[model samples]
Target: MLWAHGSRVSRLPKDRCSGITPPDKMPTRAPWQALSVVLILLWGHPRATLACPHPCACYVPSEVHCTFRSLASVPAGISKHVERINLGFNSIQALSETSFAGLTKLELLMIHGNDIPSIPDGALRDLTSLQVFKFSYNKLRVITGQTLQGLWNLMRLHVDHNKIEFIHPQAFSGLTSLRLVHLEGNMLQQLHPATFSTFSFLDYFRLSTVRHLYLAENRMRTLPAGMLQNMPLLENLYLHGNPWSCDCEMRWFLEWDAKSKGKNSQCDSWMPSPYRSGNIPFSSMPVLLCLGSA
Candidate 1:
């Protein structure tokens, strides 16, 4: 016999059941009724077992998925155990300091296709365990230094398809474990030397773990010498679709491209050595006219 939720439920011993009980000795319907009550009391209360948030589905373990909600802000009352949060295709404009404060177990955060114009400081300070963060297709213009602080364990970041024009030098300072960074399809005009370098004990060092760097479809003309130095693990570098200035200043980049041995590093506007001396290659360059003028 076992007592469940103040209800005494009787159980027959295995030795007493030899295979089948005689019709006269069989249990009555009253005992079966008691067993039904015990079963209902044990599994009837679903709210007590898992408190899933409204407009969101929380599956076993920890995963919250909410999309196309048109939510103007981060949904409140999210369970702390949620590991992944998909809030894409919403109307969120900005992120406050306390938007995602207590979610220490968060790993993947996708907030793409929103109207976020800017990211305030400490907006993601509490997401320490975050690994992949996607903020693509937003209206962001600039990335400040403190916008992504405290994300030490972050690995992949996707901020492409935005109108980003400027990135603070220290925007990616604390992201030591970052591996892939996607900044394509933006309006970036230049990159500072310290934009990707960090000060170490005695000298500056770039993120060595960064393997893939996507900077295509931007407005950049040239990169300063040693701007991408010390990235020993860098493999895939996408620098195409930009108006590359094939001048003396791009000697380092051209040399590096030639030495890449077809390792998926792309660049354009490279003239042969014979034509480098005041010779212009008009046939090799592609022209793009304005929208109204021919």
Candidate 2:
């Protein structure tokens, strides 16, 4: 009889044991076979044995946490099944085209808390399934055309807290599904009319899907006439902390903005009169409390 303790016992009586096999004569499992069985039970499942990268944490198969690692570039050996990648709190300076090349299933990519100065063309070319792209708290100075081209499914873009000075006329032309844009805390001097011209599309009539625009804390002097005419779905516009020149050139904008969206636009201060009026000093522009509309 096979005992539960891995030992064999004789079940036959002594009189019948003449033809019965002895307990010690039974076949025994080899030591290596028992060890192999133990190894198979420990590592037989792929998920239980998948190795995570060094200095990084992969608590699950779909999420990776590589924060505060001081990584200079994108790390390798990340499983392609990963859906969310958090690379925040690093010293990554530049992003090349192949940085995220094979990460097809990546959905949420967080590269904030870095020192990226400029984003090259096709830098984010492979993130087709990416929905949220954050590049905040960087040293980006300019946003040229094609700098943000291949993001079709992008919804929320946070480019705030940078030194962006000049945005190319067609910099934001390809964000068709974009809903929120945060451009506050930058050095934007002017917002060209063509900057948002490509955002309009034909649904039944011309329409825009952009809902919120945050341009606060910049150096905007005056906005072009009819700049927000195409944004049919615009709900909130934050334009405070800018030196707005309130004059005859702003008459149409003021009237249109006031009538279009009641109290949606705002500004810090406005000049009561036109600039260079009788060689008037720029400091003479009155600082009055007026919403930045029109």
Candidate 3:
């Protein structure tokens, strides 16, 4: 019997539960089990939780989609482990050098449908592992030589539907792995011979590796001689929707067009009288009189 604060309490008999162990004689947890608990608390669970960026959904471990968010600029705190980033349909006007500084694992970057006017030199130098880049439907006016310095592994580039007026001679110097280039719907009037060729002092040239090239709907009247001769692996060429001057400067293109075995080499121009609604092939149409003798 035990005496309480204001009443007396009765105790149970010692033979009530003879199988039960006393409090001091109970066995303790093994040392290995206690060590595992401590390790789990320090390292967390196996499926570790990810800290996603605000206002952007991270559904997978490698991709981050931030499209149509009305974002004026690129958001901060993006994970470096991400491989792909989609920032399309935004109002981003500019990109700094540190925009993608430490994201070495990034492969695909899509920043199209924005209002970018120009890119500073070395702004994209950190994207060493980049493969595909899309910059269409923007307000770019020129492509400087240093604008695309460090994209060594880039394959496909889309810069169409912009306001590009000029491209420097060495604008595509280090892009040896480039396969496709889309430059349609721009305001380009001319192209340098060295734009796609690397000249050596021994009077030889190394051609580019581009396969598909699009230069449609531009303001080019004539292309420099030997422009297409450098692209040996070119499969598709789009040069329609331009007022071509059928003169001696264009006679080489006509001869090359007849002998080339490319799949799609469209160089048609829109006619008015009989072919108003359709485009006539440059080789079949004799109505385009030569402005000068070839």
- Among all candidates shown, the one with the greatest TM-score: 3
* Candidate 3, run of 10 with poorest lDDT: 285-294
lDDT of each: 0.76, 0.73, 0.78
Which residues of candidate 3, in runs, are more than 4 Å off?
1-50, 198-204, 262-280, 284-294
Clashes of each: 0, 4, 0
Window of ten residues with lowest summed lDDT in model 1: 283-292
Off by over 4 Å in 2: 1-51, 197-207, 264-266, 270-294
Model 2 over residues 74-114: C-alpha lDDT tens digits? 78777666778898889998887777877777788888889
The sequence of per-residue lDDT tens digits that candidate 3 reaches over residues 1-294 is 222455757665667557677778877777778999888876674224344576777888677888998887788877777789999999999888788888777899999999999988888888889999999999999999888778888899999999999999878876888899999999999998767543323446657778898999999878998878877878888888776654446768878888887444445443344444344455643435452222
lDDT of 3 at 259: 87
> For candidate 1, lDDT tens digit of each residue in 1-294?
222454656665666556766778878999899999988886765444545666876665467777898788888887666788898998999888888888888999999999998888888998999999999999999989988888888999999999999999878886888889999999998987667643343444454567888999898878878776756677888877776665556657656666664554444543454433332332222221111133
Off by over 4 Å in 1: 1-50, 202-207, 263-294
lDDT of 1: 0.76
